[model samples]
Target chain A: MTKPDVLITGSYPEWDMQPMQEAFTVHELAADASATSLPRDVADKITALAMKGHAPIDGAYMDALPNLKMIANFGVGYDAIDVEAADARGIAVTNTPDVLSDDVADLAVAMLIAQARDMMGAEAWVRSGNWGTQGAYPLKQKVSGSRIGIIGLGRIGHEIASRLAAFKCEIGYSSRSRKETPGWQYFDDHVALADWADHVVIALAGGPGTAGLVSKQVIEAIGPRGILVNISRGSTVDEPALLDALESGRLGGAGLDVFENEPKIDPRFLKLKNAVLQPHQASATAETRQDMGALQRENLLSFYAKKPLQTPVNKTGKSYPR
Target chain B: MTKPDVLITGSYPEWDMQPMQEAFTVHELAADASATSLPRDVADKITALAMKGHAPIDGAYMDALPNLKMIANFGVGYDAIDVEAADARGIAVTNTPDVLSDDVADLAVAMLIAQARDMMGAEAWVRSGNWGTQGAYPLKQKVSGSRIGIIGLGRIGHEIASRLAAFKCEIGYSSRSRKETPGWQYFDDHVALADWADHVVIALAGGPGTAGLVSKQVIEAIGPRGILVNISRGSTVDEPALLDALESGRLGGAGLDVFENEPKIDPRFLKLKNAVLQPHQASATAETRQDMGALQRENLLSFYAKKPLQTPVNKTGKSYPR
Candidate 1:
């Protein structure tokens, strides 16, 4: 019998896929290809699929691959994948989470500090030789002792709070339920959180449930002197509302690691001086990506060996214990 | 009886000099006049003087100002002033040192994290829309768990170490004397410190003693993967050697807040993408500057009250150990 073929749709450390390649015949997609552009004929021969956040693994794609048995996602968020359809077809879907929490948390704090201090602006000022004429630029805001509000207190949010605690920030959070954590104050509504917070972070998962959670009311509540940081999915925020707040100076600044239409960011955001923009790379650190790749490889190997797969996303959809 | 008039050669917070004006008849100099070009008769009437770092308070000016009593320097590192001449004439000199320590430490850490993560480069890349063409950029070095070497573990150095402790970076130091501290390793020489550390920070004091401390040998020891951060005086580093190291890739990256001929930075440094340059603004925060102004005013008030000054420059000309 021909060995079961696996199709990998995302980039990972080459060594991580070596073990999976040894176990089965593998076809790797070009790093730049969109999900729809992958060769359709090859899809029929695929027994397992491997992918990252960018690829949409919906029911339509699942229908094309009749022999597909399982999917091992490279990172935590599976919002791009249609899990309900995969579940209906008895396809085991696994995601790599928890391994990237600390790395993303670090990036969130770095972005917050960078925005508060006007680091990018300062660098440009110095490089342009403005310092020679102006002597030294004016000072920026203080990061420590600022009031920080977290929108969602999930794994990554909690990690960010833990790191920020060391900086002496007052941590407040808005979540579905109140947490009994030591230093975190819980608020049930986003407006209340924004009204009190000097810095607001959107860390909610992206999906229909969380779409447009940060409305114009919340942005207005944050006020001028307040900074917004988004490391979570772009759909969680109202982009036009955020842009309006920034333009009107109702919001002091923003540090964005993700966008509503990613890879095609809103052009209006480029004109704002108080914004710090990054290419959705919160969890793109070498160590975190390596860990994610290793976990994804393990999930693929475990399924082939007829063992219980770790970090199953289909289980979450079924309301099973994760 | 004639009143002893005070002369201010540089700009100050209006409030800072109001108290001084009430105490003594104050004379303000033209803002743009070169210190060397001040009228001879105006210089003759000046008794107590207030000045910023850029003004040349040298031996020639000291000789010209016959009635000069005290030189209340506005900021730390009074390298522009001729301290030895002032000491010889029994003219007391004071600087706002400790007041700026925390602010400078904040910038040092900011620069360290910014440079290590290629934050400025990444920001520019995103703003220019190059990110879409370049999928995900490769990771720079990690800040956590990296070995950091600090030269001259004075107040600013200590504060930086304490702040970085939260990030879990292993701290090492090279100073004039060995000091005992938990989790801090002391190296007698900078070369050994550079050999052991992946990141080297120059926080040593300026003046003749520390001139040329970070020689070519030290730069070479801190091999290709090493990052260098200079928050200390620019004279401490040999810029030509640093440029050579950067060109040869012997040094990984650098974040420089001060330079050898500041305001006239070496044009070569401007051409490098790996270096993050600032206009000597380690203590440029508004809160820190306000504290410094208040401290300078207190020191002046104490001197007039015939009490010991708060931060008098030592007889040997060092500003430490207030």
Candidate 2:
């Protein structure tokens, strides 16, 4: 009973930590630390592991925690987790999704408009005392009423499309199959969708099947007047192709929340005046992150109560429904 | 026939300049030039003056252009022109309003989201290579579903409300008079509206009557969690009260387009991380500006054609409808 019951591998907000600490005997491990470095007593008693968005947790990590029953993920996308491995070991995996959709979608729209309107440059013009000395920032393209192509019509994509729709934008999308949605035009191929759209947004699931879905060909089809927005995983877009296109002025601009090998993202992107860079903070809003932490805790509480997991991504040893 | 038919007193997009040159014998004057500075021959021949959003055209300026029959403004706000002065001289006035409403409203929404999500800091965290080292950015408030209070219920405000509606935000407004709208909560006092709202957006017209409408009391009522978004005019807000609140952490943050002494904005704002500054580019979108130019041209052309004006904001002598 004295051993810590949970391991919070990734960090959460300080406001969320107090409640989490009160509810469970929690042990925290630094995000950069390997699981093998965990103290034996702490690892032996750990029943659940809490994770944020970007961390690779495979079977080897699972083996490090012999008694681990569930992985409570703080974000919607669980692509970084080896769910198949979790399932094979009868370990339940749960993720926080719907709670963060509005925040993520709001951010996607914000980034798109910020890029198209030259918000960053406009701000700089004012902050650098240039507006008085030089002149108004140059005019930028309007985001409203443009034909938008959405890649992957999943929950977050749908939310982004819905918000943009209110701006009177025409919606088009490329998903694996034609969805029941009637207003949005669907394309079987990403390239065709890009060609048809004035703007393209990457919202596909991030996994082996969807990696590099927005290829060089697809980006080229988007053309110069086109803006691209990505609120999904960096793996879903061709980072090198995207960088080249943006630098060469083949693509109009980008509003990116993710990047391949992010944090250590290509330094070339730093010099780009056309891109609006965000550190994968689509669901980083305090309101949404708090909700996500609560949901993660909820899942853990449900598992301990012997109830079907709240948002189970995979089935686990007789605890979740098959 | 020897008279200059149209005098362009302000700069316009090059795309608009070509058409004006073709349609009429044009006399161009620098925006900085006082009307009296124009050569007497040139000033005497001017039949109509084309104006942009800024650059004052007072009675003295109007008095200089004796043959000026009309003033066709390139922006929705004709506040820069002394309408009383124009009317006394029987000068017809028209403005480009609805054409740029979507673009302005789109910008207001974008600024709000960017401020709430800390897009600027997040970008720096990644570009400066801190995301890998510092872990993640601190969480921020969510924009979607927050109670948003608009200071005006005019066209741009209505447009902003419609777009935010899709994000599921609860909309409230304070206007001169309550409108026929049903769902939005109405508070006649700006202070009352701020007290109830999580965020307040300024959409009120800027003028002598509307100056300092967002007073110290109202801004304080919005409190620490409330964000202020201003797209309307710098005069509408109490800039010093706002600056003090933001610096003291009494008010949460701000997304400002217009400033009290813009260009020469308060240097304190540049140091605050809680601000998103723009150089009044709400309608500075290429599509919208082009459309505005076309509309301004249309008004000037209509005056020349003796047709009922397109968007007459005020009337003049025998040529305009009484």
- Top candidate by DockQ: 2
Per-residue lDDT tens digits for candidate 2, residues B46-154, read 8998886477889999999989889998889887888888888889999999999999999899988988888877877877889877767888889999999999999
Q: Considering only N, C-alpha and C atoms within 3 Å, which residue pairs clash in candidate 1?
A: none
lDDT of 2: 0.87
Return the top candidate by lDDT.
2
Clashes of 1: 0
Measured with C-alpha atoms, the lDDT of residue B286 in candidate 2 is 82
Runs in model 1 with CA error above 4 Å?
Answer: A1-4, A16-20, A29-45, A178-184, A308-310, A314-322, B1-4, B13-24, B29-45, B315-322
In order, the interface RMSDs are 1.9, 1.1
lDDT of 1 by residue, B1-322 (tens): 4555777766776666667676777778753454456677877787777776664677777776778867777887877777888888767788898878766776787788778778787787788887766667677666766788999998888877766766667899999998766769999999999999989999988887899999998988888888899999888988899999998898888989888767767778888888888778777766777877787766666665667778888473233122
> What is the interface root-mean-square deviation of candidate 1?
1.9
Q: For residues A30-63, what per-residue lDDT tens digits would candidate 2 score against the true structure? A: 7657678998977898888887647688999999
